[model samples]
Every structure is written in structure tokens, then in C-alpha cells.
Target: MDGSAYGDIVAQPNWTRSTHDSKWAGYLKSSAPDNTSRRLAVYRGSPLYSRLDHHTMSRAQLLKLALPLVKTHGFTREALSRSVLYLPGTPHAEPLSETAISALFGDGDNARRTLLDAWLDDARTDMKSAPSPIMKDVLASRLRRNEPILRWLPEAFGLLISPPSGVPPLDPSPALKHVASIADEACHIVGDTSLGLSWYARRASVAAVYGAAELHQLASPATAYEFLESLLSSSSNIENTLVNTEAYAKYIGRSWAGIIKSSGVF
Candidate 1:
């Protein structure tokens, strides 16, 4: 696997840290198939990943695989956001998306949008429990991107976030608004502001990226470049580091990619 894959794998929910490194070694041994490869191929005479491949993994599995990834590596909130953005459609994902979830999120979609938007609008918040380590030059690399993500707008941003799956298709932006409403109520249901903030920040970061990228759909090339340049140049201006990095990096990348309907400019 390449760096990105390795980075992602270590972050997978299946991974866990033991009190001893030997546990990891044992896991490595157990995960392996025969003497050929560690990759699990046929579980009970079928492709081991068949369910995951078909986007059939349940929500229980999704959370298990994804949460640990976030916690272990402290994966960026953007990464966390992406994970949740696609949760509704993930294989085996529970019916977490509910309308009663956010029915009280104001009357209109815009109001719901605003409610959802605020969950992670600020950068100072620590959105994820497992925070990714400060990657070498990742911040700088993001700031330096020649263009932001291809095409995105804040409203359409949810589409860019989440694991790739085909379980179901949703109108991601509205779904996000709904999800945010659900999330908001869920937090209140639990009565924890900090926990709510933590829950939404990562999810919001993912939307912000998609929303920012969606703007490219309306922006001219020069406009997009200038927007990205300004974002990068003004990093010091933003009080929040996480927000700034995400807006400039993952979101920007997604926005740049959105324009081309791909993942990146290259």
C-alpha cells in the first residue's frame, strides 16, 4: 500500500492498541492468510471483503472501523468528517438518518442549513477524539495547492465527505442538514455541549470542504485560484488552526476536484 492507504489503514476501526506491542504482532499474524499475504481473501469460501466491497457493511461495522481510525491516529477532523458524511449510505450502516432526527431544525432548509453549519463553523474546536498527529508539512502542502478541490459549495459539501460506498444514494446536502439536525438533537438528548461540538466538528469540516469546493462550480478559474491563494496566505489570520487547515487543504482539494468532477487537479 502507498502512504495514503497505509495512513488510512492504520486509522481503520479494526485497529486497536494493546498494552503490549506483541498484541499488534499477534494481530498481524492473525490477519495474515497462510504464508502468502496478510490480506484476508476468502472468509468461509467467499471473498473476505465481499460484504465491504458491496457496501454491505453494517453501521456497527462502519463505526467500529472508522472510530478507531480517528482515535488511533488522531486522524484529521476532515478525515473524520468524510467518514460520517458517507455513513448513511455505507454498507450495513444503520438507519441513522431520520427525519424526526431534525424536524425541529427550523422551518426551511436554509434554517436547517444554518443550524447544521454552526456545529463546526469555528476552527478552535477539537472535533475528533482520535486526533491525527501533526503530519510533516501537511499544513504547508495544503496551503500550497495550486487550486482547491474541483467543484463544491458548502451546501453540496457532504458529497465529498465519507467512505466510498454504493449502498444507497442520497441528496447529500439536504441529508446533511437532516443529519445535522439529528446530530443536534442527539447531543441534546444526551445533554452534552462539548460532546455535541466534538461530534459535529468533524462532520462539519467535511461539509465545509464540499461546500467550499462546490463554489468552484460557479467560480471562474482565476476566481478559484485567488480564493485558494487568499485562504492559504491568510492562514495566520484565522484564529483557528484546524478550521484553517481543513478549509485550505481537504476542502480546497475537494473543491478543486469538484470542478473537474474528480478527486484532484492532477
Candidate 2:
């Protein structure tokens, strides 16, 4: 991992003191030093880890650990509004609003677009006062890397898209139309779906190169936006395309639900 990337993961106050670290320490003390041993130790120690362990614990042990953590550390509106990150500007910092967080975590089709636009808008504003072209990209990169709820957005999106039990069936046309409109708007905001692809691909590639723990952060968004682009670019009739897309989307959505349920929100 690059120094800055590693710093991003460890920079938060008391991150080293998190329970995750304590568990790692315990595992290392009990196990021999080797590649497989190290990997097993880390995996066994991770709070995000999930598996069935009959003798030591039981099924869904990780879920049990995560549920209580979520309840205890749940995000608050005031706390979110107060969050800030340094950027290239006279003030050298940008404050993210609770509304932005809500929109990103909200159930609406436009939520992703809103979240991306807000971050890009701030980056553009910072770029105007930036001393160099490299600084502009730096600002944008930092914004994405340090984005609040980066770990939770996918789970939130998963929950949002999940079908609610007992809801009556309604016309699919309007919902499909709304999704199309949101896709157009997102493309407009970012210039094109190609640019969105580039943006996500860059993040994913960098994270992979750096061996970042949160690969899903990039994967989930890339999958979702690409799916949207595919829907728009398909030449098939709207009804047919919507039918197939809905099925595919539901499948992907269920995968995310399983991920969330297994891994829990961070």
C-alpha cells in the first residue's frame, strides 16, 4: 500500500486501539509466524470475519459481534454534519453535511448521483484555488478515500433496494422510468458513463493494487453504475429491457443483502 493510503486507514484517532487490533495481537501471540499462520490469525481475529466455528463458537459468530457494535456506534445526524476533511483551498478543509450523508444512504434512485455530485462539486471548487493540476486530482482522491460511511454505503444501498414484505404490486414502468432519468442525470453530472466507469475503475484498481481491506467499497458502486449504464445503452424495447434488468438487479441486490447480513455495517 502507498503511504498515504495506509495512512488513510490508520489515521483515524484510536484506530490502532480498536478491538480489531486487540484480537490480532492475541492471535499473533498464540500462533507461529508464517504466511498461512498470519493469514489465519488475521482472518480469525477480524471483526468483519464470518464463518462457522462449531467447537470454538457457533454459526454466525461474526454476526453476533457486529450487531451489538452497530447498535452502539450507529451514526448520528449531528456527528455526520461535523465531519470534515482537508482539501485544497484557503480554508484547507470541507465540511460534509448530514443531508449529503442522508442522500447517499437514502433509498431513492438519485442517491448515488447526489452523493457523487456533491463530492465532485466540492472537489471542483477546491480545484479552482489549487496551485497545480496534480493538486486537483489529489483533492478529489482524498475526498473519495476519506469519504464518510465508505464502508457502510453498499450495505445501506442493499437494504434500500430489498423488497419490503407485504407491499402491494404496482406499475413497473414509472419506477423503471425514474431509474432511467436518474442514470441520465448521473451521466450529465459526471460527463458520461465512460467517465463514471473510469472513476470507479481507477478507485478499484488502486485499492486492489494497495491491497485495501475494503475492496467491496469500489466493487459495489462500479457494479451498480455499470448496470445502470447497460440499461441505458441497451437497444431492446424498454419493457423487455426493464424486465431483464429488474431480474438481474434483484439478483445483485440479494447478493449485497447477503454481504450486509453476513458482514454487517461498519
Runs with alpha carbons beyond 4 Å of true place in candidate 1: 1-47, 50-210, 240-266
| Residue 128 alpha-carbon offset, candidate 1, angstroms | 17
TM-score of each: 0.21, 0.21
Off by over 4 Å in 2: 1-147, 162-182, 190-266
Top-TM-score candidate index: 1
lDDT assessment of candidate 2? 0.35
Q: After superposition, how far is residue 124 of candidate 1 from its true place, in Å?
A: 22
lDDT string for model 1 (1-266, tens) is 13332333333322222222123223222211132122112221342333223232322222322332332222223223233333322332332233322332222243223222322221101121113322112222222221232232333345334213433544454446533433343233334344333345543543343334325534554555355444434432442565456557877788777888664555
For candidate 2, write residues 102-132 as lDDT tens digits. Answer: 5433433333333332322222223323333
